[model samples]
Every structure is written in C-alpha cells, then in structure tokens.
Target chain A: MTSSRPRPATIGDIARRAGVSTAAVSYVLNDAPGGARIPEETRERVRAAADEMGYVPGAGARSLRTGARDLVLYVRSDAAQGPLASEFLHGLSRALRGLGYTLMQYGAERDRGLEAARAWAALRPAAVLADDDRLTRAGVELLAKGGVPVVGLGSDPERARGTGLSTLVMDHRAIGRAAGRHLAGRGYRDLAAVLPAGPPLRAMGGERVEGVREAAAEAGAAVRVHDMAYSPESAAEVVAGWREEGLPRGVFGYNDEFSGLLLGALLDAGVRVPEEVGLVGADDLVLCRMLRPALSSVRMDGESSSATALRIAEVIAGGAEVHLSPWTPVPVRRAT
Target chain B: MTSSRPRPATIGDIARRAGVSTAAVSYVLNDAPGGARIPEETRERVRAAADEMGYVPGAGARSLRTGARDLVLYVRSDAAQGPLASEFLHGLSRALRGLGYTLMQYGAERDRGLEAARAWAALRPAAVLADDDRLTRAGVELLAKGGVPVVGLGSDPERARGTGLSTLVMDHRAIGRAAGRHLAGRGYRDLAAVLPAGPPLRAMGGERVEGVREAAAEAGAAVRVHDMAYSPESAAEVVAGWREEGLPRGVFGYNDEFSGLLLGALLDAGVRVPEEVGLVGADDLVLCRMLRPALSSVRMDGESSSATALRIAEVIAGGAEVHLSPWTPVPVRRAT
Candidate 1:
C-alpha cells in the first residue's frame, strides 16, 4: 500500500547517490574510525546526497548493532496519577533531556508482565522504568537478558527482591501516616479515613488506611473507615450519614480531590470546618488553596527530579542495585 | 559490562533446544502455512522449548521485514493540554487498543521537526500523530518517505496544506466565539476574554481571543483583552483593578482552571456573578460545577474518540486526505 511513497534511503542508497562505496558512506555518516582518512570533499558529497535523499540513520539498526539505544522507556499504568505524577514526569523529562536521553511513555494496560517486556525489548531501550504492580520477576529477567536495566517504583522493596531491578519506594503509608498524625495531633479523638472503592485504588488505599490506623492507635483515637466512590454524589452521600454515625472530628479524605469533594459536601450540609471536622488530603493539589478554607494536605517532598534522573542514569550505566525513598510525606497545615 | 548476563534466546537457540532446523522452528513458531505438514508433537516441543527459554519474537525484526509495526506513535507537546486533552487521549487509546494497536506517547519538546522524525522513524511505527505546531513539512515528508502516515491536530488547516497530514482542527476561535455569543446574547455590552500570558499558551489563546472579538463585533459590543498569568496572585491582581478600569459586565476567563481562579477572586472582590458580572469559561472542566454559582462554559462536543480513532486507522491504511472537526463549540449555561 505504501509502494507509491519514496523508500527511506539506506547507506547503500547514499553510497550509490554519492558514487562511493557503502563502507565509505557509513564511515562518513557514523564518523567511525578511519573516516578521517576519507577526503573532506568526499565526506561533504556523501552528506549532501544523504540530506537530498532524506536519509535518517536507522535507530533500530544502531540498537541491533550496539544492543542498546539512548532511550528510557517508562512503562505507565493507571496507578501513580495526579498533579504530583505530572510534576515528577516534567522534572524527569527535563533531567533526562539534560542527560541526552529520550523518555518514552508506553501504555501497559493488559500486557504488563512478559508480554510487555517483549514489546519493550523490540525497541532495545537502554533502560526500562516501570511500576511494581505491572512488572513481574520473569519480565525483569527477560529485559536484563537483553541488556536493558530495569527500575521499578513500588510501595514495597521485597516485591523486587531477587529481580536485579532497582527499586524506588513511593511510601504511600508514610503519606497516610503524616496526614493521620496532623489531624490527630490537633486533638481530634474521633477520626476517619476515606478510601476509594475501586480496584485500581484498593492496594494504595489499603496501605494509607493501615498507616492511618497505626497513627490512630498511637494517638489513642478511635478510627473509622469509609468507602467512597470518586463522585460528588458519593461524597454527599457519605456526608449525609456523618451526623447519625457520630461525625468524626477528623477525616483523611484519601487525596486532595476526594478531600475537596468531602469538604464541599460538609459545608453544604451546614457543618463547620476544623470545629466540626478537620480534614486532611494527600498530593497537595493546587485545588487545596482554591477551596473556601484552604486544605491541609500531605505532600511528598525532599526528592528533586534531577536527583531521581541521576539515579536512573546511574542504574542504566551498570551501577549497583539502588533503593530510593524520594517521597517523604510532609503535612502542610492550612485553614482546614 | 552486560556480558556476564545471559543473552536473550534467539530463534536458533530455540531450534537447537528443540532439535529442529531454524526453518522448521520459524514455521512452527510463526504458524506459517508450511508448518501444517510438520508433526503436531514436534511443533508442541518447539513451542515448549521457546517458552522455557523466554524467546519472544522480535518486533524490530518483523518491522524490518514488513515495513510497519502495530504502533501508533503520538508526539506529545506542551501545546495541547488540560482535562479535555486527557479525555481525548483516553478515548483514542481505547479505540486504538480495540484495533490491536499499541499507542506510545513520545515527548517532543525541543525536537519537533526533522530531528523528531528521525527518532520516531526508528520505531518503524505504522503512523505518527502529532500537533501541527510540532510537525514540520520536512519532518512529514521524511516520515512519509519511511512509509509512516502523519496525522496532525491543530487550529489552522492551511499550515498542513502541503504536508499530506490528516488534520483535526481544534477550532479554539469557534470556542471563543461561542462564549462571546452567550455573554453578548445575555445583554452585556462590555465583554472581556482572559488570555494567558505565556508563550506555550499564546497561539491557541490568540485564536480564541480573535474568536471572542468576532462575536463581540457582530453584537456591537466592545471587546477588551486581558493578559493574565496562571496564578492566583495574577487573578487577584486583575480583579483588584477591575473597579478602577470600569468592570466589564461579561468576562471569558480562558478555560475552567483560569475561570475557577477568576471566579474565586471576583467573589473575594465582592463582585456578584451573573448580577454585577456574568462569567464564562471554555473546556467546561468538572471544577465548574464544584464552584459556587456553577460556571457557564463553552464545551467542545459531538466528537466521539472512537470515530476519530477509526478515521486515524483509515488514514493509516492509505485512505485519502481527511479533515476532522470533532470540536464543535456548545455553550453550557449554569448559574453564571
């Protein structure tokens, strides 16, 4: 079907156009050893012919020859979302760019393990960065076999044990613990944590809830768990029954989005903020400030993007196994 | 450094492990027509050996032979953004996935032309989808030469006139005009449109402002331009000076994010929405509903992602040039 279009020029085509040997064309294009012996005039002619023919050095061919390319493939899943994720990506992108590497995000939905590795291996990227949820031990072995370094971001280090993959722990539990401590320290004996009733959120939500429970136990406060969907209606429904269920004086509404929703619903239900209910959210989205009573949120800080990028580069360069805890959750106190 | 690790098992390795010729292995693994004559037990043995060794058929080798891979490379830039962009992507991804195509997002920040094309061509993707701002004429031609279809999403169709790119016009001007019409029709003689004061937002912002102007001129209303940064401080500063400069009865606060910012500041400045000042925003984010006096917005409607994906698929199949206008501006009226 594409026969009508001009074919991509190969080294042989450039050589034919320049009236030189394929070896000479390669020497000129790649600037490899012995290219200095070729006359500058011949080199210029080869380059001109290559430009005219719209020749692009095949990355696939180069990868096949060198067994690696200047690419950092990030295998993305539905998890690891929100404004923080965006910030991480923008920072990571800029840092990788500075390091002369291209960051490619591959959507790995259904095929996360062995199947995903096969597809990534075809590109022959220098390294692969993936979330632990989507990465399997076998997948890491296969990619390592292909000479591709694998870095995994997860909540636990044990999951990546024996896989030869560098691990960056997100520490969502710490984030939850931070939120729990902030609210509990404010002298609220009745506390609650809102967990999203979705499969994708279940694992992370459970961890955060566990952290909140740990904090509550230490603070001598009773903890209640509320299952809420990611909808305004669900928020309103949860708020409507708060009074009868003995309204918790402090609530951890999962993340900033859910916290914002709960805050809005509480206000609509004629409940007072901090006086009636002190709320905390994670991720510290900008919406926290935009809300009526600025939200108090748990923010993952301390690790800069450049530092993370440098670590990734080190891993790609055959460095020893590294573990990074970039997300140190710090609670920012606001009106709410 | 990677020499110590075992290399990926090749087809030859599988052949040797299964005690069969490479040709027999290829036919068995590929399920080629001639493989029908091969004994079922031998085929199973070959498959078992391949599985044991974690032998994955190289997509690079397949693309080198077939000239295309089941990859749709989306060249992402900073231009197209916001929640609507996410919605479009989700829809497009689902559609492409249904077609057995893997969608890969490539970050093209500084490398937007020939340099970008060279990187994309390395993957041997079936098609390259990019914003018109990023895809140059030379880049398109080079990718076309490599037998990759180019699809561009932009505001102007003329920029892609000679590039043979399937264009999807975002029509920001139409969106602005819709907001302008809605506000003007409500009997407001003085109208204003918020334009973000950043280079990345400039082109699309300019087009949207022009659209608002066109609608204002048609209704015999005065149009005032306001350049604002993407910060609460900027919004507050703009609102603080509104009384001194004669507050416009109608205002189009760019998209929902800026609009939400403006709404908060206006209320802080004691200006009643839809009473002292009627306000509208574009993209109609969920934040519109969350705010008090639920925002009136101009939303791009009537385009299903499935349809766009289908069109893209047809284009990849070498169909004729296609122009799609999925973004039809529709003004959604709320409290303000």
Candidate 2:
C-alpha cells in the first residue's frame, strides 16, 4: 500500500476547482463581512466544490485571524468527575453549544496558577471556566491580559474583585450550615464534620467545618472536626475511633460518596444509625436513594447551566462587576 | 476601570525588547535548526527578554504552519465514564504526554459518521480514537484523506481492514462466554443474559447474548436473553417477571453498574441469590465488594493503557496491520 494520501482541501483547492480566486472562495466559505457583494452563482459554485472535496474550515487559521477560538476552556479540578459535577458539565456543554461556543474540558488539574494560564493562553480560547481555588490572582490576570475572560466557581468571590474575573461563589459554608442545622433540628447536641485531609480539598473543607462550628454555637452545642483520606479503610478507622471515643450524636461527611463509605463502615461495625447516630452528606447523588437506609444530603440549588452560560456570554461581551452566589445549599432529608 | 487590557506578548514584542530582528527571535524561541550557531550571549539576552515579557508560543500559529496539532483526539462514548474506562483514560493521558502528545477528549457522542469526522478534522488532530461502533467507513476515509489516522476500539476489527484504520477489538461476546461458562460449571442448565434495551447499548448486548448462547449449546444447556432499561424500576419489573414465569437457573447483567442495580432489586424482591439463581456481572467494580453477599462479577484482563498507548504511538509512526484484542473477560467468584 502506498503511504501517499490526499491532503485536506484548502481554500486554494476549492478556488481552483470552482474557477475563482482564493479570496472569493474564502469570502464564500467564511462568510466574511463583504461576502454579500459576491454573486450567488459564484458562491454556489464554491460551496459545491468544497462539498465535493470534503473541505473543513481550519480552526487554527481562523484563530490566527481573529486572535481567539470560539472555544470555552474548562480547566477541570480533581473532583469535577463526581455525579453532580458531571451533570453541570453536560448541561454547560449543551448551553455553550447553543450560544455558538464549544466547551473544551482540560484534564490537567495539577497545572495550577500562571503555568496553567500560559498553557490555556496558547489555545487562545474566548473564555475559561474553573472551579474551586485552582486559579490564583496572577493566573487570572495572565489570562485577562491574553484577551480571555474568566468565570470562577469557588468560596471566595472577593479574590477577583479587581482582576476583572467573574465569580460564582459555591458557598461551601452554606452547605455545611444546612447539614449542621438539619442535625441540630433532630435534637443532636454534639456534632462532627468529616472532611478530606488532602491539600487540594482542604480549603473548601475548612470553610465547611467553620459553618458547622457556627451552627453548633447557635444551637448551644459542641462540634468536632475530623479529617481522613478518601478510602474505605480510612472511613472504617474513623468509625472505629468514634466507637472508642464516644460517637457524636450527628456527623456529616464532606460529600455523598465519602459519607456512603462511612455509612457502610458504621454498619459493618454494628452501629445503629439514626437511633444512636444521625448521618448527613452534601451534593445529593443518586446513590443516596439506593443506599439501604437512604442517606440524607444537602442539595446545591444553583442556577441552571443555561443561566450560567448566559452570564459567561455577558462577561465576554464586556460586562464586568459580576458576582453570583449561584448555589444555595439546602437540606434534603432521607432515612439517614 | 479602563476596558483596555494588555494583549498577550507576541514574538514581535520580544524581538523589539531584546534589540534583535524578528527572524533572530524566532530562531531563539522556536529552536529552529541552525539556532546552535548563534552566540550564547545573544541567546541568553533573548531568553531573558522573553521571560520578562511572559511570551508563550501560540498553538494556533504553530498548528497553521505545520498543518497539524500535537493533539490526539478521543471522541468519548456514553460509557466512557465507567470506573474501568476512567482508569484507561487517565493512564492513556499520562502515556501520551510522555510521548510528547496531548490527549483531548471530545464529548460530542451524538455526532457520528462523516459529520463527526468533519468536526474533528477542523481541529487538525494528529490522530483520533473512538470506542464501539461510532464511526462509519466514510468517516474513517475522510479522516485518512486529511492525514489523520484513526484507532478504534469495538467488536469488528475487520470493518477497518482496508481503510487504513487501526482497531482494538473489545469482544463483548467473550465477556458473555465467560459468564456462561461460569454458570455452566456451577451445573446451571438454564441461564440468562440481561442487557440494556436502549439502541446505543443494543449492539454490544446482541454480541454478548450470542456468546452466551454458544456457551450454553456447548454445555448442553439453554440460554435466554432479556433487555431492561437503566433504572431501578425497570430492574424491579424484570425481576418481578422472573417470579411470575419460572426463573432462569443463572443470570448476568451486561456490566457491573447494571448488574449491581439488578442485585439490589433482587435482594429487595426476596430472591435467594446463588441458591435459587446464580448471578454474574462484568467490569468488576468496587461496588461488588461493598454490596451485601458480595456480588460476583467478571474482570476484563486487558493490557494496560500504557501498552495501548505504545501501540497507538506505533500506528502514528507508520506501522500498519494492527489487530489487538485487549480484553479477556474472566469470572471473579464472590458470595453471590
């Protein structure tokens, strides 16, 4: 077999086939501003030739001329693959597509700050959406300087006050407060908040613990903070420690998946749920209903992805001073 | 606040700052051949100026010049988020990065055939990887015409025999065969294979059912096939039907997630697992161990993603006639 294969049809190839100039072919294909002046007959010829040759407009060439691709880069964080996160992404993708933009998820979660900004700038995306504390002030500025607007979802909206970065505060504290209040309403005087010990998860975890502490104070109760790795063994060990150190009346895991693991461990250790200890989790996953006792969780009542996409469109259209707390975490009671 | 922000530093800006010609700056930055002949002092000055200006190479410009991006596009399937799939993707990403390539996952699962090929071609990826029966002959040919190689993972490797396409056959039939043999070995003369009824999942489902039928015939047994939607209600309905019409001696769900759902519904319906009906599932998930009585499953003993990446690298480097059956499904016996 010969290694030689036909190269992609270029504007020149289309022009030659259509018996027109390259500029004429470009005008017909790209729909440039002055394309109205071109004859419809010529336009039809160019289009026909392009279709026959299977011509696709080069994204790279278009980006070179316009200095930005019609692409929205999403620098995904480590936890962005969770069920709730997946829903947001799928919706966001569809919303952005409706607005004539493609959402490209970048899986280089470890690349943070200015290093990440540089890599993103190389692609010349129209906008970038990031979650949590992945982007620093300098990173935001770097992207801004590269003609790319940024929309952030994190605990701190004030961090972008002067950086021209639009922020949607996730309010992890609100999630914790909701969980704590639910437990307190159930007549629990002693409470605990369990969170991941990893550095990447610590910032949000800290805010949640603070919310729990605040709720505990309002209820005239005491709250303890416990940190553990994301593993079944770690959950079992935590449950074992609780068994020895006297279990709190109520406890909330960082999220549903982690809490589900704790529920499993607690059951294995012969601990009676609700009667002895009430449990809660946040980011209400479908698994909550499927669990034996049905885990109680907090739902983030954020605006639809369509709404967020419109806001992003506004940011790109030179509308700044955007501050949105899209999420309002609310308690969702189940058996647990 | 002023709407005017600093644009990204360009090669021309670096040239001006370093008091050098544009060509000299290009040679220093792009490291073009013959750059070694330039004086060390001049190179240092250019590098220092570039660092101070925060100039990053434009991916679009580079792609335009070379007519291809150092991107390996993976058009993800609906099932690409499964636990096993995630592991494969993560490992593939790392391996591709080691080979100086970036793996970009395009989440447009609905677009298939020549339409998807045209879209992927616009980005000018070096190669494309797809799963199952997504791409058609025209799609593969269109990509080949544009010098973009394709590597597919699906049931039919012969489908790409003369299309300059590389395929890694995922034998769904083998998965069913393993489950059937496991049930047959347990002395179950009547067996059943359950799968999703949705069109997207039916092709692989059909292949698995055929394999089960083959195994049942060899063992002098009989096999029945059933289809259910991906819902707890659907699973309950299926299980309820078994109670009405005599139950099969053994059953297997298409994969772990589906099978796990079946296991839950079975236990809820007062079905005695293994005793009354032996059960099996594929893609042994972590949920298998966490479930009550520990659900039995089959593990896909496929080559590591690193190995597959190497094979892909070989394909990109001009080696042809590649055929790989990366999976050999084997039974994993548990309490269920």
Candidate 3:
C-alpha cells in the first residue's frame, strides 16, 4: 500500500509531455495574455498533460509571477470568540472563497501595535481586514504602504475612517439601547448592565453601557454597571450583590454567553426569571432558545457584514476606491 | 490622521543606505550561511538601515530565497465549531506562533475529496493538519509528493497510519466509555448515547456509540443510540420519545452544547435530572458549570493534543521523521 512518493509535476514537465515550449506551457497554465490565440488543440494538450500529472500552480509562484495575491488576512482581536465570531468568519470565508481568495485569520498582537502591523505586512496579503482596535493608523499606513488594501470593522465609523481604511461600522450601542428600551418599556425602572471585565471587551462594553444609560435616562430609569468576567461564580457574586443592595430587577448581560451564565447563577440562587428578574443578551445565539427563559437578544447580521466586507475587498482588489458604510443592530425579544 | 501612504522599503534601499551590495544586504537580513564572515559593524549598519526605513521582508520573497515556508495550514472539517473547536484552535495557534509559524485555518472541501487536496496543495503550505475523514490516502500522497508534511487527528490510528500520515489517534470511544462508566457507577443501567446527525460528526459519533455499548455490555446494561441534529427541537423530540417509551435513565448527549440543549428540553418536558435521568456530555466546556444540575463530561485535553500536533509539525518542518501516539480521554463527574 505504501508506494514511493512521486515528485510534484512542474510546468517544464508539462511542456515536455505535451511537446510544447516552456513559455507555451506557462502561457497555457496561467492563461496569459495573447495565449488565447494559441491553437485550441495545443492548449488542450498542455492542459491535459498538466491534469494527467495532477499539477497545481503554486499560489506563491503565481503571486510572484503576476503580482496578484490570493490571500486576504483577517486580524482577529482577543474578544473574537463565540457564535457571532464563528458566523462572521464562516460568512467571510465563503464570500472570499467565491472571489478566488483565501481568508487567513491572524491573532492580533495588541501590545506590539506597530510591530504587529509590520509583521502582518510581511505576509504581503492582498488585503487586511481588521476590527477598530486592531486597525491602528500606523498599521493601516504600513499595510497600505506595502500595497495591501485595508478594511476596518467596528462600532466607531469615524475612528476607522481616521485611519483611512475602508470602514464598515456596526452600531453596538444600538443593540444595548434596544435591550434597554425593551426592559424599560416592560415597566422595569431599575436596571443593571453586566460588562465583561477585560481590555479586549472594555471598548465594546463601555459603548453598550452608554447606550443603556441613555435609554435609562430617557425613561427616568436608573442603570447600574457591573464589571464581571464571564463565569458562573462571577455572575453568582453579581446576583448576590444585587440582592444585598436591593438594586435592579432588569439586567442586560454583555452577550448570550454571559447571559447564559447569569441565568444559571440566578436559577441556582432560586431567583425565578421574569417574575424576579428579567434578562437580555446580545448576538441571539442558538443557546438563547435552549435556556429556560429563552433569552432576548440584540442581533447583528454577520452575513451582511461579511458580504459588505467581501464586496469592498473585491472592489479594492480590482483597483477601485472604497466607500464607507454604517450598519445597525436589531433586537429580538423573547421570553426573557 | 490620514497621511499619504509611503512605498515599502526594498532590499535595494537597505543596501544603498548601508553602502553594501544587495547580496550583502540579503545575507545580513536573512542571516545567510557564511554571513558570519561579514564584519559585525557591517551587519549592524544593515540592521540599522532596515529599521530606519521600516523594511519588512515579504514572506513570498523570503520563501523563494530560503526554500523554507512559514505557513502551517489547519484544514477544518465542517464540525469545527463550538467551544471544543475554539479551544483547540486557540491552543494550536499559540503553540505554532511560539514556533514562528502561522496556523492558517481552511475549511475543508469535504465533498470535493481529491480535488480539495489539489486545491490545498496549490497553497504550497509547509504542512497540513486535518482530521481523519478529510485526510484521505490520495490527499496525503498528493501533499507528500509536493514535499508538504501531513498530520492526521482522529479515532482511527490504523487508518491514519495507513495513509502514511503523522497520526495522533485520540480515542473518542474512550470518551464515551468514560461517560458510560460514570453513569453506570451511579447505578443507572439503561443508557442511550445521542449522536448528532451529520457527515462531519457521524464517524466520531459512531465510535463513541461503540464505546458506550462496550461499557454498557461490561456492566450487563443495554445501550441504545439516538441520532439527532444539534438543535433544541431535535433534543426535545428525543426526550419526548424517551419519556413515551420509558427507555433509559442515563444519557450521554455528544458534548456540552448538546447536553445543555438536551437538559433544557428535558426540564421543559418536566423530567427531573439525576433523580429521573442521568446525563453526561463531552469536552467539559465552560457551559457545563453554568447549566442546571451541572454537566458531567468526558474531558479531552485539547492543550496536550495541540502541543503534540505542534511538536510533530515543527519536527516535520525541520525535515525529521514523525512518530505516532495515542491520546486517551478522561471523564469529569459532576451533578449530572
């Protein structure tokens, strides 16, 4: 069963096998300019020879030859986790693959900053797609200097635009505001918003808290901010503290994971959901429906975001200028 | 904030500033063989010139010069989602990064089979890491022919070895057996193992079911297999059927996500856990602690697996032979 390994066939091998010149093989393989004028029979012979040997044109070689790259690097922040991140990646991967490009995910070096940008630039990707925190002005300039187009995604369009990147800014504040409005409209005047404590999450959490505060102020409701990790113990402590202080009956956990953890903690502490406390989460993850109270959440359309990013990347790859756009989040009300 | 983009510094620029030949600059930049003969002062001058201009050596150009690659492609099957997958990727990414290699994940083209292998080979990756189903003999041979090392991870060590791949055989059966043993030790006789219905999951699930059956047989208990999708409605239907038939008192629902979903369905159906039915999950994801009754699970050491894979990858990348290893799963006992 163990046959000796055969070497990968090269264009020269194809040329020899097809009784053609090396240049003709290269032209046929790469579909080079003026190669269409080659006799159809000769082209077919070259392709057949290549196919017989299972020859694949190396992307590195192709890029070097044509100055066209097939890689699009997506720099992910530390907070790039959960169902939302997965969905976004899947969508982006599909979209990029359709455009004959591979989406490569690189973990952002937050502390390294400019050094990280230079490292990414070293890859010489056709484009770099990143969120706000990962897309610093120096990073954009470095990438752009290397002739790689840059696209930035985040809550702040203005901040992304400041870096001169093609920006697709989604309103995370709107998600929080929607959750706040739902809870406040239900006659819950006292509310508490849970924010996951971490540098990676703080920026988004702060924006969400502001939105909650804005909605709370409009309804003459009070909002308390709780900074905690996404853990059952952390949630349990928050619940205990809320009970001790007699604070709020309505809460908006940062996202579904936090909401799920908090829900479990609340239930463990004998707090009946809705009857005792109402909760809302973001992302509207599938787990939301599986939970006892069926979590209410703000839904961001990752598919649309992915489509827009891919389109911008395609346009930029085609040497066209990019225009900025703003995306909004919608709320889905459920049992919670 | 948007300054006009500057051109990326080239080797010629570095050579000119350092008052050296392009070959000398390349030697200094790449630390080429015999570069030791270059005076320390000259090397320092070249380094300073490169830093001053923010010169980054492109991966493409470097690969061509050194005949070495920096890409370690991780081909993910469709089942690559959820906490377990995320944890595995994070661990692998960190491990590879420490070794100065980027772990690029590509979604496997399962349906395309050998054609998919050809597509991956086109990327000219330094190595390819994939699971059993995706790493076919033809794929392995094709990659090997291109001088690309292949690593396969799955339950079937023999099959993976048959393809001449560096195999890390993780026993899914052991995971299921552990779950079965835990439930049986708790005096639960009748057992049912839930297998998620999908091409990507069926192979692993089948092995797990066999393991459960083996354990059940040892304890003089009966084991039944339930095929369901990873959805709450599917879980609810299974729970409903079990209730109507009075089938089993112990169940293992694939993994924590499925366990959480099943637990919710069981609770909604008024079935008390532990007292009425014992449940177990795999992966022991964070959600296990957050779920009601807390999920009992079979814990596969993703960190160890990732480390081993990275070690094998590094060895292969350094042109060394690969050794095979067996990895076992351990069960964590909890409320359910």
Best by TM-score: 1
Residues A174-221, model 2: lDDT tens digits: 888889999999989999889788866778788888888888889998
lDDT of 1 by residue, B29-81 (tens): 87889889999999999999987887766677766656666889888785334
Which scores higher on DockQ, 2 or 3?
2
lDDT tens digits by residue: candidate 2, B183-269: 888899988888789766788888888888888999999987778887878888888888888888889788776776777688788
Model 3 per-residue lDDT tens digits across residues A1-336: 443434457888899999999999998888899587889899999999987787887766666677677778777765436676776677667767777777777664442357778877777677777766776677666666667777776635555444556765556677789889888988999999988898777778888888998889989999999988977889999989987998477999988889989988888888899788999998888878778878888887544745675676664565334555534667788876
Better of 2 and 3 by lDDT: 2
Give a tens-digit lDDT track for model 3, residues B1-336.
443535467899999999999999999888888687999999999999998787888765666567667678877765536676676567667667677677777664442357778877877677777766676677777777677778776625555544557766657788888888888888888899999898777777888888898889899989878888988899999998998889588998887888889989988888888788889999888788877788899887544745675676655555344555535678898886
Error of 1 at B245 (Å): 2.2
Error of 3 at B149 (Å): 0.4
**Interface Cα root-mean-square deviation for all models:** 2.9, 3.3, 4.2
The candidates' DockQ values read 0.42, 0.38, 0.37
Query: What fraction of the true Cα-Cα contacts (under 8 Å, chains A to B) does candidate 3 also have?
Result: 0.42
Pairs in steric clash, model 3: none
User: In lDDT terms, how accurate is model 3?
Assistant: 0.77
Runs off by more than 4 Å, candidate 2:
A1-55, A66-68, A78-80, A131-134, A153-155, A319-321, B1-55, B64-68, B77-80, B131-134, B247-249, B274-277, B319-321
Q: Order the candidates by TM-score, highest first.
A: 1, 2, 3
Would you estimate the TM-scores of all the predictions?
Answer: 0.91, 0.86, 0.86
